[model samples]
Target: MLRTGAQYRDSIRDGRRVWINGERVNDVAAHPAFRPLVDIRARIYDMQHDAATREVMVATDATGREVATGLALPYAKADWYAKRRAVDTMMDAFGGVVSRLGDETIGEMWSLHDGAGVLTSIDTHFAGNIQPHIDRILDQDLFHVSANTDPKGDRSKRPQEQDPDMLLHVVRETDAGIIVRGAKYETAAAYANQAFVKPTIANWGDAKLSEYAVGFISNFSAPNMKFICRAGFAGRGSVEDYPLSNRLDEIDTLVIYDDVLVPWENVLFNRHTAAAAFIRSTLHRYAAFPFLQRILRFADLLIGAALLNVRQTGLDKQPAVQDKLVQLARYREGIDAHLIAAIETAQESPGGLCMPNQSLLYTGRLLGCGEMHNAIHLARELCGGQICVTPSAADFANPETEAWLNKFYSVNENWQAEDRRKLLAYARDLMNSDYGGHRLTFHLFAQSPPYAQAGAVYRNFDWERSAGIVARAAGLSEAVDGRKEAAA
Candidate 1:
């Protein structure tokens, strides 16, 4: 089902208790801290219905009903391409990067669908719950997010040993369902409608069964839920000076679930440690594609900013600057090539759904996310010291400094003082600001940490192929090829 932008706005105004900077937000949709991102999300909903964008953003499902392409199960490489194009369209429309939007989060459920066999082994009812929740996302056009990491008090001791509330566990099972109490660090939960809550990463250590192993769908508007958010970047400063921060800061939140109830149907997996572990292992299998795509756009932003800065200053004529620009281009296209090759060699999942080639997707994630800081620093260097030392918009507007600032800032007829000021301001927001640092950390650890990302690359890489090639070259035994045995 397709929802108009108005319906999307009305849905989040359900009076979900939200707090930012210790102040109660009466309406998240209009609050300064949230309005920018909320408006961006709402515009995406509108894009699904807009005449020019609808074709890319909306697709017909099996029932012949048009639904958001982000929520649709990816059935082929074309579906992956469509999802990528839609995200690019949204980023182009909004002129900034905002990850954790519904498109990126819905793929978490697709990972679960691929692991339904594990759920079936634990409980058939749990297995039955996977697809419908995904369908409900499309049917209601709901905004979805994922809740995985919890503020575990101490890693040294288990929840059973220390405070049990550290990890979200099933408090007790009622006839209706399970009551859960815990907090999750979710980035986009304030304006989102629901989340797929699961155990914190690798929290269930060596336990065959535990309450902390539970995973369920959470309704954001449910009673006893509260969204306590960090100080937002939007209301912190002038939009002219901090354009990206004011418009694209996706405020992270510590969402407290004060003994909320989850209906039986909403309970995805109860007291199943293996199922929980299975999910943690393959959580980003499908989702990482979209996540990597965001990084690619960010790379473009970096390269574009650096390239323009050099051109404005006439430094592009020099070979040293050109070399740095080449490095940035290589980084951007490295990620681009990975995405293309991943789709080109897309693999069919055990669930019969087509997913990007696991190795390329994961290695691409590492390249895109791991080297983002270096890329940003390169952009920072290319943008020059002016990005950090440039006067604010207010200072530039001052009667005392306007003439002097313009005289210095203006490079040529093509590059005026105001345009130069805007570029520096944009570069500062993208590189040197608090929002910039947070985004760096977000790309570093948002999907998982660097070790885990490398671990995924390790797990998915075809070690046997390399080994088989060496064995054949060395005239080793046929026993080295597992494929031959399988063929027989």
Candidate 2:
């Protein structure tokens, strides 16, 4: 079921409505805003079929059918390692980072599969769709993304008090399926094939069942879907001046459902408020691994850019510069350690799939995301102010300014003007440009806000065990010790 790059390119040309920068995008695969990522995504598809890279890119499902390595359910640590290799290989081939590609979002569905017991008690019919939908991903090689947050206008009021369409909800029921009317702000909905749509809020306000507490699989080809995307960085600047921005900016979209029909078979949960809470709590159980993994690569970028900048100027010999490089190194290793340890301590989900250790995932995400700005600042400091003041690629090439720029930029025999310009450009795009700011903010809140990320760690951590250990050490009252033991 491995898809070729060409096949992936053709799949998104189904006349879906998509707009960006005040213009309609007739063809997402060919449009400048999406084409770069679309091509990278296509290359990911092609990797699994290429003989040289197939070993790491393809995996055998339970049925022995070959599927994309990233889509397989993790039943063992080795499966996770293979996925790591696949993501690494993809980034290497594309020379950039891409997080939303099916690998990261697939885990949201996996979380639902683990929550099947909760769904079954809520509604048996919708409960049955979990495993089958997961199987479909492996069978069809679907380019799946996640849909969680809605526009959520007027946070002060409930859905009933505000415009209910602000949050996605099931508007009506028909014999064929449930008709949903609302919208979601999805990252790649315009280019992706499908999305697992669900509630964004944690509290249902004691409701047992509500129209908004629904979860279902949405197809981009469904009727009345509209994609309103933010302006992308790809075509906004020259690749020579903004390499990372041009190559790696993933255009995000506000996807409007506009009364689309979701078949009963595609529905994972319906009117189960408990299902909503359960999903909110566990949505990133497996997904966070890939998200956090992407940050690891970003760490490499920060370190590489800063180190190259310092080395070109012979500033690396200084003790101050050396200390700063170590700081970047520590940040990189910290994220890498969490990724490796999460797999080492992986546990089986209730639905019989292996998920990364929860504590490590949340803690690592917080560590990486929480300090993203500081890390950027440290790297930016090491890069010096030259990155910000450097001449544009155009200025460097112009005959009038070429010699003067080269005379000033070129350092020794090894570091030429061109190489120095490229380094500064690379570092600038990450630390001083519009794309740098966008990405820093993106990572800071990628999973959720800081409080939410800390809350996840708070809930998943074994605080009970720690409390019980303290009880034993302090010789607390018998009741307190007994309660702690019972809870543990």
User: Per-residue lDDT for 1-488 in model 2, tens only?
Assistant: 78988988888999999999999999999998898889888988888888999999999888899999999989999999998998898888866678789999998888998998987887778888888999988888999998878899999899989899999999999998999988898888889999999988776897898999999999899988999999998867799999988998888899999999999999888888987888889999999999998999889989999999889999999999999999889888999999999999999889898889999888999899988788899999999999889889999999999999999999999999999999999899988888888888888776788999999999888776777777888878763564556655
Q: Tell me how candidate 1 scores on lDDT.
A: 0.90
How high is the CA lDDT of each candidate model? 0.90, 0.89
Evaluate model 1: give its TM-score.
Answer: 0.97
- Per-candidate TM equals 0.97, 0.97
Candidate 1 residue runs with Cα over 4 Å from true position: 477-479, 482-488
Compose the digit string of candidate 1's lDDT tens values, residues 236-321. Answer: 67889999999999989999988999999998899888888888888999999999999999999998889889989999989999
Roughly what TM-score does model 2 have, to 2 decimal places?
A: 0.97
lDDT of 1 at 98: 91
lDDT of 1 at 350: 85
Best by lDDT: 1
Model 2 misplacement above 4 A: 479-488
